[model samples]
Target: MYTVSVMEDFIAQHYLTVPDPGPEGEVHSHHYEAELTLSGPELDEYDYLVDIETVEEVLAVVRARYEDALLNEQSKFAGHNPSVEHFAHVVWDLAADELDTDHLSTLTVTIWEDDDTWAAYEESV
Candidate 1:
């Protein structure tokens, strides 16, 4: 299978809920990094599974929507914590909605809250 990835970084604030509430329970910013990966068994006539420019366009939208925003203020958070795991899925949904998935086999979104920690969500298209 062929795979392509697009990456971007943004700043956002969020708090976690579960077990003990610590400083993380307070709104804080993370230099978050997100990577979106598209994979398939075939490529188009242009020898690409997906257009890099298309990926960048979608990523730019995602970044613009979330960059410098308070995660808890977003509709997607509703009543849930804006955890990295949830963030990954949120990004996946946004990117999937913008892409033509007919030729793709899978889509995966990985979010890094810090250099040492990250989470991912993947789905078959």
Candidate 2:
């Protein structure tokens, strides 16, 4: 399948909600990077898996909502953990909410908490 990916970076703060989160339970910030990938067996007449610019526009909007904010305070995470895994899934949902995916077979969202650590969420669109 052909794949097209777009990436962006933002900053956000969060504190884990677990009973024994320890250091993670404390508020902290991350220079986060989110990459969204769209893949499909067939491309449009233009031969592009998807428009990179369009994808980026969607990401920009989504990322802006979380920029410099605390994830725990967002209504989206009211009953959820603000971990990398959940964050990636939330981003994927945000992107999919606006982007047309009828031509795509799969979507994957990767969130980098840091250069050395990351989490990804993938599923059929």
Location of the lowest summed lDDT over 10 successive residues in candidate 2: 55-64
Stretches of candidate 1 exceeding 4 Å from the true structure: none
Query: TM-score of the candidate numbered 1?
Result: 0.96
State the weakest 10-residue window (summed lDDT) of model 1. Answer: 14-23
Compared with the true structure, all predictions reach lDDT values of 0.92, 0.92
List, residue by residue over 1-125, the lDDT tens digit for candidate 1. 99999999999888887668788888789999889999999999999999999999988888899999999899988888788999999999999999999999999999999999999999999
For model 2 the local lDDT of residue 34 reads 92
Candidate 2, 1-125: lDDT as tens digits: 89988889999999999889999999999999999999999989998889899999988987889999999999889999899999999988998888999999999999999999999999998
How many residue pairs clash in model 2? Answer: 0
* Per-candidate clashes, comma-separated: 0, 0
